[model samples]
Target: MRLRGVLLPAAVLSLTMLAALPLPSCIPQSTPPQPPPPAQPPPPLEVTNPILSGDFADPSVLRVGEDYWAAATSSEWAPHFPLLHSKDLLHWEVVGPIFQTAPTWSEGNYWAPELAQDKGRYFVFYTARQKGGPLCVAVATAAQPSGPYTDHGPLVCQELGSIDGALIRDENDTLYLVWKEDGNSRSLPTPIWAQPLSEDGTRLIGAPTQILMNDSPWEGQLVEGPHLIKRNGWFYMFYAGSACCGRDCNYAVGVARSRKLLGGWEKNPLNPIMKSNESWKCPGHGSVVTDTQGRDYFLYHAYRATDFVYVGRQGLLDEIQWAEDGWPTINGRRGPGGKVLAKPAAFSEDFTSSSLATGWVWPNGRQPTTSVEAGLLSLSPPADRAADPIGAVFARSTNAGNYTAETVLDVSGLPAGMAAGLSAFGDPENALGVYVRSGKVEVWHRERNTHEVLTSLDAPTSADGKLRLRMTAKDGQTYRFAVSPEDTTWTEVGPELSGAYLPPWDRGVRVALTAGGVAGASARFDSLRITPN
Candidate 1:
């Protein structure tokens, strides 16, 4: 199947505007109508199952002390990228975007972004289209690991068709970069190149020297997601190769090793250790990281096809072992699944009430418009910020299974056209949402960023407010939503919504309150709670 570039229509802005309206205070106290009591709380947020499935590709992860950070490629999607973090490898959260400011020039698309922590600062080196033409690496840095990152510099401009770039600082404080040049034709002719970095770890100091070229039949089709790792005195180059779509798109991981930063690298004798369908199918673009234990591990995404064509992916992990010749092998060729992987860390309940968890993202550049008070979160109308006015909250899919999110929203003070809602975001185009709007409630679905209003509710209110909402996700693609004001009255707003999973590279999901049109009315959220269902 061919992957298509998706654009969220401007029509969504009109919808947000049409729904934008100011809400009055609780129904007059003199005529206070007794509202129903609230429902009993759901179970605690526990990891009952896995969180991600289907097509989670080009994963890059960083382990900073007790914290782990990662980002992935979101090709053809605007604000195109995913940034994820974890305490333990199992639980992941969508923290924020690499570029929250209207992306300066991302005309072509964004591929894999390599995240690193140098000294005490966090940096992300990602590829985007330059203002004039071609792909280049834009660098953003922040004081904290999960950031409000600011772009400080740009590199690899001009004639290079760059993608999949990574940074590495050596023992003596030497910095180097390794990446693939896609050669303009969009084919696998792309070759991996490495160059030294300047003192401050910003720009390239010298010309990049070609280190590896695709020659294997398994790779002549394509070679992508180049990641570099230094261990045991060897510079290991990890990359993905072969076609990326269709049954024939044989994506798998390959490794090449060299003694110097730039060198005569040797391809692993046992190349393409991870394959799919023929074995697992479309299993490529793997990222390697060393856990706190100093044990090496590989994290990647792959497609597991069944009877028909279904677009879904599950995150996989495998321990790295040397083949006596110093080449890395995964789970002894049984792949990420056959191995008994060690769990990372667990998510904490003591999150800052105002700031999002370190790693998470919102679709179409949507952000929080409200303030946090007494543990209650409030949101302003969807103003023209990025693309979509509806904001969202997200966390990584810790595993591939079932999960749920619930929150208490006080929309009685909202405007007539305004809405208070919770959304499961994978990308701008792919997500599921349950919301209360225009005095009615509805379920929203999207393929890429295009949406379909699946269901609606007719719950009238005179204004003393609190809407209890819950969204249950069965794996990553299917979702179910329900709302209630009183404990005894529960309304199932809609059946499960259907969509594709956005990789950690593109973006994750978040809960948001939005106005359809230009009237930027605000909505209030009393208690925002999310747990694994």
Candidate 2:
């Protein structure tokens, strides 16, 4: 059937096929080009050791929701107990203090504060010296973490000296308080003791039981700073051992576990889980916490292994992990240094809003005559003549081992015997002050109640009646003092002073703007700056 041999044009054939096909509306189409996925943010930078760079010792931290709150020993420094707040474990800021004033019954030496919350009320368990009495554990209560806490007197220690009070609540909600016996006084073995606590955490309910003592060679003369935690149905007790102060401070942290809360305690085979290394000295007195992501962390204090031992113990952060055997171990296991850790989120603080930064503290209490105006800090001598110079000193903790502090002093209209300037103060008997006295600039050093003039120079004759004073703390070992007339050219005023004389028992040295003399003595400090070396 070569039947229809009729030739059709190519255009006609194409038109016929198109007309027979379905319409364009019925045809499927390719998807339009899509935008690229949004770019992800970079990870936060890692932080180094000593996350908190100042004298934050015996750290006890608590996690509440997204916030982490910490309390540290502020021995003889008032605002008695310092409270720090952080969103991440890396960064922290001072959020006032646990007590604006020391307890009336307690004279000085406020140490290790452990903070906890129950039924929405905050409680602080701390150690303080009673007026002319032995050091003992005490309790305080507040409505919030950053507190104006009210002291509830001392915990029952049965006439025994006690310190380093730590609190723990069991799964059954039973409360207990653990403390260290002050054995340093009697030259006996320091012991860890535990007692039941009342529901409100204000009173001791039962007889205290001694759980552990300084038995190991590593535990030198003391086994103190007890902290309790539970994991995998076991009670873990962490305690610090050895001397905690001075050049001989060989402190370390050890662990003990018990199936029962108050009995059958077993020390870890690998004792002294955290100890001093080449970079950090006397690493101990630590607290543990878990983050929102279920990561474990430990916070402790350590002194830099430099010639300058006067910087005191600064706060350190390290991550911890658990083994299959159920014991916890720090990630690096050595000590906090060299390793870069992930930083916590940033925090905001207004250091200039107040006359003193929130971090500033006085040795005993703030003087009534001290005032802050328009960024100027004014210090006036106490009206009481018998009061110690330590009380009148207005200072801030040195945040780093090596740093420089500078201030402009307006010493106009000063009386003959009055002096006002910068001071590296440890106590009434141990300090170095560079001041303008009797129309001359002099550097004085006080050692063991004897004050000696190191050097003296003519005061810079500035028409504005102001003197620029600067102190450089180098390597935490030596201090250099200088004076400037125009705040431009500085002249070395005194020989380099040895900072090693500053003992750790004095809790290192505080840089202060001091005014000392009879009544009506006042000094104005302006443009104070502290920079890390």
Candidate 3:
């Protein structure tokens, strides 16, 4: 949908201007203009649920002074770990990533990053599976929250698998790292463990102690994504359990408390504190943070049950209050919804700047040839990388389930086999897109090794060789494609495409501009407009 300002007709404009001119003696003055309607208290800030509307999961947040910083799992989508910054808990902007490139030792499956600051240095502890190896927790250090973080090496590794690492500082200044011992494959219950860390926050100091394991009936087959916070002299560990992906995903967050940092823990009778409700499904993997005013909140992820599961898990936020009995409750025991919330302090991004907008990221990092200038983003397909899952793409998460994304592409320069257009990408195999190639525009969908062409139409001829493409996603389950020679009018190109085939393993669908083929092909895209419907 296009946004335009209302305009006045020529005759109406003339009369209105004349009426305002010399209303002097002609129109009797109204009785002194009555005090401006008491200023109507500027409509309450309507913050929306899922403050962050896209596939950002396993959020770990920390409040530093007045600023809040967060990091989340990128899995196989690179740029390593994603970092977000906000002045308030309600709104966030992407501040690039923690690692500019994947570590040499790890190939993919980077998940669950926890950000922490010790002494004065910032550290990020995360899980990465090395090529042909097991999943392990690793640490990286940077002077700033969003970093060119330097890998400090593995912090926790086991023969089976170890993932989801969280760091907490105790009252006595002791630092401890908590992580999960993955056991889903062996049919054994997954367990949480803790180990002390050195002063520099680089390595573990002693042997690990097992904290808790999957014991509740609702926990399904695993317990992971452990986050620890201290309240009222007690250590509270919040974790996610049950199946984390797919149509029947039963993921939920449960809490366990302990008097001692390492042992003597008891699960709350309430058990799963957060779970799926009518609107959002699989709500779990949460991290808690307190605002500047000391109000507490739970930041987590959940899927829109009505949308295709491949839409991924979007970021959600809910207010939490401590009960008289010292237990925490989320949104008065209600789940996520479309209800209006109070807006956080205002934040904005300038895409015209040389730096990429804080809301945009390149999945699996960016190719050296990818560059952004002014408002135009250009990408050159890498040579011999046709088989890469991520290919050459620059994407940003869909902040809402229903939205319209439009872009103007100059694909004239693309080689014969090269293609460029807008796409809803989950991975190389699972994507729905409308691409321009060889003087033709085609709509296609891919699932794993199968690629199907839904339709193709002749590319509209333009003097400048620019094509305008628009994609509308409804409830995140279906997509429609349209094209235009110019931005003003559009023609539907293909039938509505179903996204039902998208799988949860592909994570959430990233709306992106993609350029790829056999090497030497490049595409320039500009005027990208993403609007929520």
Candidate 4:
């Protein structure tokens, strides 16, 4: 066996002798690894067709068994406190306005409405204020889903300065109400309060206790619209704070949680769960619902098109996931630095009937029962609002860029002034309709509260009351109305509209065939459609 000799250099021996020198404790260390670029925002709801597209603001939703019901504020708009129902959450149909038999106080006071189901009865707790008026809460109840709910008087009487009253029931079956109020107007910030409800769940049984004070910059000057829920032994309150319209609007939803229902609640370390600026202005006033699968969702309203004449508040729904710490995040947007998830599904024409589509909505809560056969839809005239008309077949506007509305309608057997036409109705001064009036097919435009007859033709009228008409819209405010006896023979009766978009009092545009009091006369429609150019 050969033994190898170890050779040590003189410098190595001297360094070893210099001994083990210790480093200074004050020296800083290298930065910790960055948190994997916050897992990219989950994709937006892949909504090929969004259910709501016009002024469906401050929405509140409830999922009862397999059916989902929703309500929204309808400020200054007649047929107030509208309610909508859905089976898939993706396809929603208008059930009825909650306050069809609304009280005298309900006229100008349509605002945020919260819905709840107790026992077998449905309850709608809503708020409203007159023009330049004070806000108050009212309760309405109905046995069936679609309601002609009668008001149960004031939830909180006489006292003013309260809105957005949301209800929640604890595991112990104790009911509570959370709402916003300016209890201290000047010094302290606007806050949210909660109290136990009476055993009946119609009125408050205890005094309101302050649950949270606005402290977040995203909360702005006001903290309102409080909704509470319990999960995992913690009570979570979701609220929207700040104005939510136009350039100045900076609205967002914030949350706080506590182990106890009454105390020790903490403002979420992360807030402004949802927000938008400029392009998607005013994203606030949201509500959450749990689906049958136990998944959570956030239903909110946001402004898409700044064209006040064409667009206002629109409903947006996205999936929500809760953090391990118990705070919920919308579409997984992180604080003020998140993105809105796209809508969840595409609109399908599967449930469509020639007589009525899911998109149709009637003003003042009245819809005409119609006839559908062999691809032809016949609308019977409604008794009331005969001058204004009753039924409309509308789809949510989907003009991401250029907005165009083109449709084919046939007007035969139509009575005089009972027009076969197309119109867009939502905004104050945004209407462009083409129909047969006074025995002639004519095009009319209403811009920002003014009406104009643009063009007309001596179009043929049908003894059978059927006509084929098509109307096309472009930009934000231009339209062209065309008519035809059949799909092949099309004629232009109106010139390119310059300033028509949405007309006041018209809830939505559809193939309107209203009879102006001529008995045995009605209008027949072939096809109606809108295409954004």
Q: Pick the candidate with the highest TM-score.
A: 2
Per-candidate TM equals 0.69, 0.86, 0.83, 0.69
Query: How accurate locally, in lDDT, is each candidate?
Result: 0.62, 0.77, 0.77, 0.61
Sliding window of 10 residues with minimal summed lDDT for model 2: 341-350
Residue 323 accuracy (lDDT) in model 3: 83
The Cα error of candidate 1 at residue 64, in Å, is 6.9
Better of 2 and 3 by TM-score: 2
lDDT tens string, model 1, 1-533? 11256554678656666678554586453566878899664432222112233334566788888888877665543344556778867666665556654466655456667787777878788877776788787677778767877776567764657777788764455887777787625543677777888766678887788888888887865677887887788888888887665434566788987777676688887888767643244666767877776667777766544311233344556667767777888756654454222232333322337664443333334544546666565556345532243543333333323455676677667677665677765555566687777778888876665767888878644334777777776644567788877535677887766644533333233333333422556666665554544
- For model 2, residues 81-155, the per-residue Cα lDDT tens digits are 788899987788888888887788888778888887778988888988888888889999988777778889899
Could you give candidate 3's per-residue lDDT for residues 91-138 as a string of tens digits?
Answer: 787777787688988877788888877777888888888668888999
lDDT by residue (153-230, candidate 4, tens digit) is 566532446777878776577787777775433445776777788766678887878778777777777888777777
Candidate 4 displacement at residue 526 in angstroms:
5.0
Q: What is the lDDT of residue 41 in candidate 1?
A: 42
Model 3 residue 506 lDDT score: 33
Q: How many backbone clashes does candidate 2 have?
A: 2
Full-model lDDT, candidate 1: 0.62
Flag clash pairs in model 2.
47-341, 308-476
